[model samples]
Target: MIKFNQLRKVFDDGTVALDGVTIKVEQGEFVVVLGPSGSGKTTLLRSVNGLVSPTSGNVRVNDVEVCEQSLRMVRRKVGMIFQQFNLVGNLSVINNVLTGSFSTYNKWYSNLYIFSKELRIRALAVLDRVGLLDKAYQRTDELSGGQQQRVGIARALMQQPDVLLADEPIASLDPMIAYNILSLLREISAEDKITVLCSLHQVDFAMHFAQRIVGLSEGKVVMDEPQKDLTAEYIRKIYKTHDKGLFFGPESKPYSDDQLVTWSEYK
Candidate 1:
């Protein structure tokens, strides 16, 4: 449902975020982009909904090109979750979710932040889907970190998007909270048939939830394979370091709680 062709991005400072990166994802597939910091994961995700304009090459969603002319349509088809939650902290949880439906508003009514009854009902349903129905009337800032991220997810689902792009959505949360968020995302991808492209540095979460894993290093795709086929050597290459002592060899056992704790440092 998504395609990236020879995409390259060079910022004003001459830092290349993506270099000749090409990847394709099928509808309803849950894919994870695994890379250390500065590996272009964020840039790659942003390119999908026109948040980041590529210097060259192209990005297409559901056969529609993502560009200035088609940006509105592409954005309507895409939903984004941010690392920072990106909600209006003072707004009630339901109101925050209602913001996602703004794209569907008419030009005359878009500025009022006034939503239709149908939209409000839909928003309530989305909040319930994220397990926050009881907190819909509560202030967003008063919610816990994981609950706030759930609010973000509810907001994204308000778009009824065909594709969901989560840019390090769990980076700031504790390990258990992060697992809950990932589990919720996986459930949404499976039950809702929404294509999910989540960028993460955590290997265990990706392995547990993703059907496909795409690894990036520097600004290029270093490895793209099914989660079951990914190897420890390729993972090490993706991080570009051995000092973490993350893996011993191809035959190495699964990471223990201590190793998982060490892996958390990458975030």
Candidate 2:
């Protein structure tokens, strides 16, 4: 469902985000990208949806050339979720979700009128699927962090995307809330047959939910293995845990959401 060939992304400051990376994903498969800070995971995900254009190489999603296609066209079919829940603070929960359906709207009606009945009904159903239908009328800023994240997922689903790209989606929530969100994502992947490419920092959760894990470090793929074939050594290399002491004894670092949010200092 997705393909990347020699993809490279260099920022304006000459920082290379993705370095000649190439990968492919099949339809209906859930893959987890594992790496510490500065890896190419975020660049790769944005490239698939045309949010971050590749400097050279090609990115194809569902057989369409991502770089060549219009961003609106690619985004309509490829959904993305961020670590921070991206929603309009003033808009109602349902309205934020309806924004996701903007791609399916007609130029004339969407510009002059409100949402159509068909789109409204579909939005409600998607909100229900994400367990946020009852909160539809509430303002988005009124929601708890976890509920807001769920709102983000519901908004993405309303797009009816063929591929879902989640960039450290659960990194902001507490462990229990994080688990709930991950489980919901997994359920959606199974029931909807949506291809999921989620980047995660939590090793245990990635191993638990993802069928295949791809590890990147220093802008390169260090380990790509099925869950059953992975080990501690492989994880350590990707995360660089040797001198970090995060995996040490009882006094070691704890896996807190705050730490995940403040990733610039993970080392």
Candidate 3:
């Protein structure tokens, strides 16, 4: 349902965020992107919704290329979750979720933040799905970190998107809260058949939740494997020694340079 062909992103400052990367994600598949800082994970995710245009190559969602002309259509089919829980502090939780429905309204109504009864009902349903129904009338700022992220999920669901893109959704929460959030995402994907492409820093969480894992380093894909074929040692090889902190401990088996596989091999 999503495809990236030879994608490359080069900023004016000469930083190449994505380097000839290519990847395909099937419908309803939960794929996790694993990468450290500056590995192009966020750039790749943002590219899907045209938030970041590629310098060359292309990104396609549901067979439609994500260009300036197709951005509105592509965004309608894609829901995004951020690590920062992007929400207006003063807005009510329901009001925040209502923003996702702006595309469905006329410009005047949308500009006035005037939602129809049907849209309000739908927003409430999505809030309920995220276990935030009671808090819908409360201010978003009063919620806990985990609760705020749940609100973020509810807001995304209000779009009724076919694909969900979560960029480090669990990066800020505590371990248990993160686990619960991941669990909720996994359950939603399984029940709704939403194709989820999420970027994560935790190897163990990705291994437990993702059907397939795509590892990146220095703006290139270093590993792409199904859960059954992904060994801890193989994943350890994807990260350089200095970069391997919590993912790999000192007792883990070391890998030789010859054993490493390049992105070209995947082609």
Candidate 4:
């Protein structure tokens, strides 16, 4: 459903975020992007929906060139979740979710403020799916962090996007809350058959949830493997030693570099 070929993202300040990276994601797959703080994971996720355009290379989703076409339309097919739940604090939960369907409204005639009854119905349904139906009428700022995050998910689901890009979706939450959110996302993907691509800080969480893993370091893909085939030692090389849980550590296993890499999958 999504493909990136020779993808390179270079900022105006000469920082190359991504370099010659290539990845293909199938429909209905749950993939995790694992990396350290400045390892280009966010850049890759933003590029899928044209939030961050590639300096060179191509990003195609559902056969549409993300860099070439109108970003307004591309974003409709790609939904992004940020580490911070980017909710409008003053707006009601239902109204925030309503923003996702803004594209369907006739912008020429409406100021994107006047929502139809049908739109409201759909927004409520999405809120229910995220377990936030009761909070629909409440101000977003009044809710807990976890509830606010659920609202964010509801907003994304309202778009009916085919591919979901989560940029450190669990970074802001506690461990239990983060697990619940991950489980919610995975369940929704399984039931809806949507492609789920997420960047994660916790290695154990990714291993437990993601079907496949893509590890990045210094703007390059160093490890890409099915979760079952992955080992702590192999994950170590993806990021430098500073990345603890990702490599062999107290939580991870004692991995060694001698374990042969699965090169056939890359081929």
Candidate 5:
């Protein structure tokens, strides 16, 4: 449902965030992007939803190119979850989720603090899905970190998106909370048939939750493999080589240069 071909993103400062990357994610598949800091993981995710335009090449979602003309429609079909739960601290939890429907609401009504009965019902249903229905009336700032992120997920679901983009969704939470968040995402992906492209820093989380793993290094794809075919040793090698200090101690493994597979093979 998503495709990137020879995608390259070079900033005005001549910093290349994405370098000749090409990838395709089929409908209903859960793909995890793994890379260290500055590896272009966020750039790749942003490109899909037109948040960041590519310097060269193209990005397509459900056959529609993510250009200026198609951006509004593209965003409607794509949902994003961030590392920091981007919620309005002063707004009620339900109101925050309701904001997702602003794009679809009538302009005159959109500015109003009150939402329609039907929209409120939909937002409540979504909050329930994320186990936050009880907190709907409470201010978002009063909630815990995990609860806030759940609100983020609920807000994204309010869009009823065909594809979900999670940029380090669990980075700030404790490991257990992170597991819960990812498990919820997995359930949503399966039950709704939503294609998910989630970027994560932890290899173990990627292995446990993703059907496929796409490894990136220095803005380039180094490995794309089915989770079943990905060994811990292989993951360690990717970190050891392209990621270096990104992984250390027991997580790092020793491997020779010949063991590293060519990116073209995955292509």
Candidate 6:
């Protein structure tokens, strides 16, 4: 569903955020990008949706090349979740979700808060899916961190997108809440048949939820393999060598190859 071919991104200051990165994700697949800060994870995700124009090479989604003219269509098929839960704090939860329909709404009508009854109904259903229908009338800032993130997820679902891009969606929450969010994302991906490409700092969460893991280091892909092939020792090595232990928490420990198990086996 998504393809990046020899993609490169260099800022005006000569910072190389992505260096000849290439990867592909099929429809209905859940892939996790594992990387530390400054490893091009965000850049890679942004490029897919045209938020960041590539300095070189191409990005294609669902067989369409991502460019200036195609961005509108591309974005309509893509939904993004931010780490900061990028919502208008004072807006009601329903209103926040309705913003996802901006691409489909008339500009004048959208500016006037004139959403159609159909949109409102759909928004409510999305909230219900995220277990937040009761909170629809509440202001976003009034919700808890996990709830707010759920609101974010519901907002993304408002697009009814075929692909979801989550950039460290659980970074601000507690470990348990983080697990809940990831689990919810996994369930949603399966139920909706939406392709998910999420970036994560935690190796354990990636292993638990992702069918495939792509490890990045120094703005390039260092490893891309199925979860079944991953070893705890290899994961530790990826973080230590690329991120200098920034992503590896205190509880991290290397497991022998014999202890490694595929996600399906774990289940």
Which prediction has the highest lDDT against the true structure?
1
Those runs of model 2 whose alpha carbons end farther than 4 Å from true positions after fitting are 107-113, 243-267
> In angstroms, how far off is 180's CA in candidate 1?
0.7
lDDT of 1: 0.89
Instruction: Report lDDT per candidate.
Output: 0.89, 0.81, 0.85, 0.83, 0.86, 0.88
lDDT of 3 at 38: 81
The residue-by-residue lDDT of candidate 1 on 85-185, one tens digit each, is: 99999988988998888888774564566788899999999998999999999999999999999999999999899999999999999979998999999
Candidate 6: tens digits of C-alpha lDDT, residues 1-267? 999999999999999999998999998899999987888899999999999999999999999999999999999999999999999999899999999888878978987778999999999999999999999999999999999999999989999999999999999999788889999999999999999999997777888889899888778888889976666555655565433233334334444566554433433
Ranking by TM-score: 6, 1, 3, 5, 4, 2
lDDT at residue 28 of model 4 (Cα atoms): 87
Off by over 4 Å in 5: 232-237, 240-267
At residue 22, give the lDDT of candidate 1: 95
lDDT of 4 by residue, 1-267 (tens): 889999999999999999988999998899999888899999999889888888999898987888654677778878877889998899989988988776667774335457888888999999999999999999999998888889999989988999999999999998788889999999988899999999996667777788999988888988889976666554666656734433333454434544323322212
In the range 1-267, model 3's lDDT, one tens digit per residue, is 899999999988999999998999988889999887888899999999999999999999999999989999899999999999999989999999998877656878867778999999999999999999999999999999999999998888888889999999999999789988999998898898899999997766777788899998878988889955665465655566433334533434444435333222311
| Candidate closest to the true structure, highest TM-score | 6
Which scores better on TM-score, 1 or 5?
1
Q: Which of candidates 1 and 6 is the stronger one according to TM-score?
A: 6
Order the numbered candidates by lDDT, best leading: 1, 6, 5, 3, 4, 2
Model 3 TM-score on a 0 to 1 scale: 0.90
Give the Å error, residue 44, model 6: 0.5
**Per-residue alpha-carbon lDDT of model 5 for 120-198, expressed as tens digits?**
9999999999999999999999999999999999999988999999999999999789989999999999999999999
TM-score for each predicted model, relative to the true structure: 0.91, 0.88, 0.90, 0.90, 0.90, 0.92
Off by over 4 Å in 6: 242-254, 260-267
Better of 1 and 6 by lDDT: 1
Q: Quick one: RMSD of model 4?
A: 5.0
Which residue pairs does candidate 4 place in steric collision?
none
Q: What lDDT does candidate 5 reach at residue 236?
A: 57
